[model samples]
Target chain A: MTAARAQEPVIVVDGVSKFYGDVLGVSDVSLRLGRGVTGLVGPNGSGKTTLMNLLAGLIRPDEGRITVLGLSPDQPERLMRRLGYCTQVDAFPAGSTGRGFVVHWLVASGVAPRQARRLADRAIARVGLLDDADRRIAGYSKGMRQRIKLAQAIAHEPDVLILDEPLGGLDPLARAEVIGVFRDLAADGCTLLVSSHILHEVDLVADTVVLMNEGYVVAEGSVRSVRAELTTHPLQVLVRCSHAGRVASQLVARDDVVELRMHADRGGFVVSSRDADRLHLDLERIMLEQGATVETIVPADEDIQAIYDYLVSGAGGS
Target chain B: MSDGRGPLLPAPSLRLRLAQAAAIARLELRHVLLSRRAASVSLLAALPLVPWVLAAIYGTPGRASLGEDLVGFSHFVDGAVLRLFLLLGCMLAFAGLVRREIENRTLHYAFLIPVRREVTMAGRWAASAAAVATIFSSSTVLALALACLPHGRPAVTAHFLHGPGLAQAAGFVAVIVLATATWGAVFLALGLLARRPVGWGLLVFVLELLRPMLPLALKRLTISWWLTGFLPLRSQVKAVVGIPAPPPSPLAAAIVLGAVLAVAALVVAWRVRRLELAYSGG
Candidate 1:
């Protein structure tokens, strides 16, 4: 766990289980999210959306309790004022303009009409949709729709934001811009729980991560910590050198090296090491003793994608 | 985006909730007033005026005097406008209050707001009732005016000024407003509870049509029975074939209508409290 998790949690879930009849939505899930972006990473049907919905009070857990900002999800009148959710559902009311949609929500939430317009404009500009603010949402492209949804979610300037795939359907530039916005919100002390299938993007924006699979939280924590906790699945490292067979023969004998495979090109070898820090320290000595010319030493499994893959693919063990 | 305004009105006051509800009502009013459904309901509300206009322009066979015309108009208002047109119009307007949002997948937008669900339901129902009531009430007035058009100015003026014409017009407007309030709530509740609210609305329409033939106690259970007590002209029941039971007193009618409205509102609040955005199944 990161130091952020040790802070006063703004959101707390305890033994939360949700079901749609006999189909499990999320089960036995527990989490504490403090200030900053906590990425909810999961494959499809992995209960990522369901968990977000539960926190946003869109759906209630059949068997557990959740509190956001010390208030229960059931108390929407109190909870929703401090919370904002950008749902995955893409549909909007027919004939609504982007600006009007945001303003309508603000007004409906009791913001004064004049202030709602001002805030709407600010939010539209924040999402970089000022050029299309007055345009009908039905005429917008998918990426623009995503931006408008984000604009509405933040128009109220909520204390806690729950985003379900807020980055879906955006181009690389827009994605980067939105990630910058997420960082800005987190910097302002907003607690954001964002869900995304794009594991690497989550890695970029989230301070901590929760990995869910098949209706369960398989793993969660800082990316490095989660990787460190998976002892069974030793960290994989790609080592490029002038002599692959020599490096593999030397590394395979080490106590920390669990497995080694020479690259197909015979110019490099992939080493699985239980102790990555120790492996890194010995790499220079091993290269010097063999008179090997080392090119690259990259930890292949240090990022969220590899961690997600290992955890989700069952290679890391239950 | 945080202007550092601190948290939103920490505990929303009653005035704040009312403001939120009013805002919702305004938004819902636009949807109910501008849609194709509104056009069809407006046409239905004005349908009773069509015959009156035709009769005013071209005299009918054995055209009756102004008094007889007024009687015939009241029966027409009772049978055609209130029973058929207004009933269907309220069904069209109110049953779609929640269902339309679900169909558009926009219900979550309202549900996510800090306002209470009960407040949202009240706001939507109020807007729909206002729209439907205004349409039918205006049509009723026009129909009454056209019914007296064939008569000379002195006679028409005397009918409205000295006779029961003005009273009948006021009574029709009041009954229309009350009927809209009560029936709108019923249909709104039906929209929340039923998968196919229109089908359930059809069932309600049939039951109302069969109300006059039911036993007196059962007749008291129908909305039309309580509303009939408020009609100024008694000719509507006199024209019917059976020996209709005595109508309830105006106070009793008001109390009964209020009770039905309260019950329907309670049902709507109960249903909306648990309403989830399961748009996929819908």
Candidate 2:
């Protein structure tokens, strides 16, 4: 984590709840986000977009309060100057060029036209869309549209950016380039709340994550910390060694190991342990004692996919 | 996130607010004046020019004198240009300002800016009013020139230079401007408040059309009655309609129209301030 993530919160949501008639949007969603990239991960209809909308002042919270950069969303004159939102809606004004889209929004935010143009060009370049910046947005591809939206959101140099599914339609190379941009921005102390369905990408880009399910945040904090707190589910590790039988025998007898199963080919074994640190130490000691040539020792259930499967999908629930 | 540097920018001044509004107006003006909707408004505005152009080419049916032609032109302006074409044109222009954006899911762009929503609404209203007024006012002028064309060059010059022709043209332009400004505000507010602003705009048009037959007190409430106070041929209008009451003084009419404009602007501001982004059925 960067030092920027250790600073005071830039966005504070206190027991916020929203409802759309009989439907629940988000319920009791409270979060404190510092300066850095925070992935907002949830399945569809999990209220991730709703929470972002509330922060962006697209909708008012029905039951609680939120503040971004110490200003209420209702105070848009002050809040919008510091906050930027790249909404998931993939629509633009008809007949607008990509550069015109960014520059017009900047000018709307009180930036002078010349400065807006310069800043728009800079931002468009940052998103790697300088070549297509002058093309009409209606002719842009889906990924190009997403990049232009990102360009407009960052054109004003806002302190906080709330991006809903910002990386949805991107190809692999563009996704990596966009992830690099996020990293660069986070390193410069900009706070970003990014929501995406690509869980592994979220794991790659975010320093912390807020996981939601059914309109409620089920877990939050750094991925490792949240994984550590899930004591009900044991951590799984895949061990590959020359002497799998010997290593399995040694690990199965350990107090930390709860379950063990040998691989079908008998070249390795999967071990479930209550304590990952202890399991790693035990594997190292056993491998040395048995003269086992261990080729790979991988944590099988510590990533975001496992966490999402365990918490959101209720897979193998104990 | 602020780096302990406090705000990177100061609170926007009133001048900045006005500049933001002007920027929005410039963008919206381009759309209103160039979009397919603009073409429709142009067609509506040009409707009055057709008969006048034909008269200049083929002459009037009875070979009417200049005085009679002027009287006929006055009626045409009051009835076709002002009552029918201007009303429909403003409806098409102003009511589409917010409604079209909402339908297109583009209103959030303006809402996300660091300016008040009222400023956004005002900017859009100003653009619509300017576009409608420019198109219809230019049409009115061309129609007047064509109506006066077949009366011979010397007589037409004397009528325009020394007679009431200049004042009449100016009155038509003033009425167009004032009517567009006031009606544009009302339609803008309706666009925010109503799900179907065209229906509401047509209802308003119906009320405006019925103003001549209403009681004096009720007539005073209609935009048409107040606009009539500026008509150069008020006596000709009165002679035909035979209404007993005198029209409101020009100053009183101006004040009433100004008051209506202010009220409509306030409604627009209030409605837009409370607006939430609900674009599902837009």
Candidate 3:
């Protein structure tokens, strides 16, 4: 790696494709992930979980190779030693307490019995499940089960962490706490790859994003850079003002504005702009000069769904 | 690339690998024991003993023919019913040993831990074998004691030591253990190689069942062919099937079982190395 790229990518997928027979798990997918929290945002069955499985060595890609921290995906004994994966699946082996589940996994990882218990305790405490550590996992609530899974993954403090839809089961408070845990791990220089269906959740903690649709990575980079490439797609901004009619007339006069649509029953109008930043400044100028009283201005179409739609529009075609 | 975490777990070694496998066996033992998967077979194992216990305790008219009853019980029930019962029971437990975890979506946790896949497979096999043997072996001993106890303690003692009685009992135990171990390896390998092992189980059953009908040269291939030689009393049913040439000597029978064990170990070791965890793959 060049000095400019000093922190080498921890995971690399080179022209990889996985197929369950004819159905594509992922097609010619390639990615390079560095040391930080990276979010994988995609709709259901868009190959997010499939890609995680490939990295975790739970499945092999039929076509191309995968490397995790300079180790092959086939080498679980080596790859898993430096990595921890938290899956969305909540089913644990029956008849095990939270403590047993975490500690036994640590023991299986070659930690001595006494130390495994101590580490399991710390990990459980970190996820705030210490009180319920003695209870069977099957009896845990959905959010509690989510925390315990996180607890097991972080117990060993592996350098590379992969989580698949980990936050879907959490309440707002637990979600915030788990996100805090991710931040702390990343702050400690751990590489985190987190997948989620919600865009804003990824937007919260991810330093970069890998967006996918229909088994292909639609876009990947810093959220700002990825959003910048959607230049041709109409950026919809919701403008709420007292005199919507007057504001729309002035906003349309600008070259950046593509079109305008009025809200059904409000003092607001949706402005389609080629450049949202220029349109924002122009809207302000138009509002001040027109003496319009505006309630709120929000970017309505800047989320992941809009980006995915623009990139993979014809993917479902036969 | 370091995360600046504390010291890592021990480096992989044979000692640690076996230690990890033993720990996994300990963890899995409780779970397998409490599962309902073995319920039907367990009930079947104990059911045959219930009649003998009732007969032994009460003054049943069949008590006068105690020696014949014991022999019949040893050959027919021990060799046939309980042997098949352990085969099916152990098959159920060991076949799904790895696959059930994959099916339940819990197998990834084993893979997620920094351990060799072989360790987990060995641990699961050990734990399943331990649980199956505990339940089935007890039933075997109970059924034999029930038949022999009412014949009078002194007579039973004399009968057990002097005659083939002791060797016969030992053989039954040996057969149960070897059969469970051998088939456990087979089905565990099948479980690892494919998603649904029921089809493989059926194929093995047909092949073993046809072992007798084939010529003597082919007979050596069946596990039962070697195992049947160790029985203390000759099997009446085998007389009809034809002993072919006289059954191989006891040492040869054991050597054949050892070969089966070695083959089983190789299959398990080979399959687990490439065993990928995918629920849909099964």
- A1-318: candidate 2 lDDT, tens digit per residue: 346545779889999998888888899999998778899998988889889988988888998899998889988888888888999899999999999999988877777788889989999999999999999999998999999999988887788888889898999999999999888888776789999899999899898989898889998999888888888899999999999998899888888889999999999999999988888888899999999998889988878888888889976332
User: What value does DockQ give for candidate 3?
Assistant: 0.37
Tens digits of per-residue lDDT, candidate 1, A1-318, equal 345444778889999998888888899999987777899998888998888888877778899899988888777888888899998888998889999999988888888889999999999999999999999999998999999999999888889999999999999999999999999888877889999888889999998899999899988888888888888888899999887788788889999988898888999988998888888888888889889998898888878898888889776553
Winner by DockQ between candidate 2 and candidate 1: 2
Q: Compose the digit string of candidate 1's lDDT tens values, residues B78-122.
A: 678777889999998888878888888889898898889999888
lDDT of 1 at B44: 90
The global Cα lDDT (0 to 1) of model 2 is: 0.85
Candidate no. 3 TM-score: 0.84
lDDT of 3 by residue, A1-318 (tens): 354444788899998888888888898999999888999988787889899999998888988889988888788777787888988886898788999999889987888889999999999999999999999988999999989999998888888889988898799999999999999988876789999876677778899889877688889988767767787776889989988888898888878888899989758989999887788888898899899898989887666556656665653311
Could you arrange the candidates by DockQ from highest to lowest?
2, 1, 3
True contacts kept of 3: 0.54
Q: What DockQ does each prediction reach against the true complex? A: 0.46, 0.49, 0.37
Which candidate would rank higher by TM-score, 1 or 2? Answer: 2
The candidate scoring highest on TM-score is 2
Clashes of 1: 0
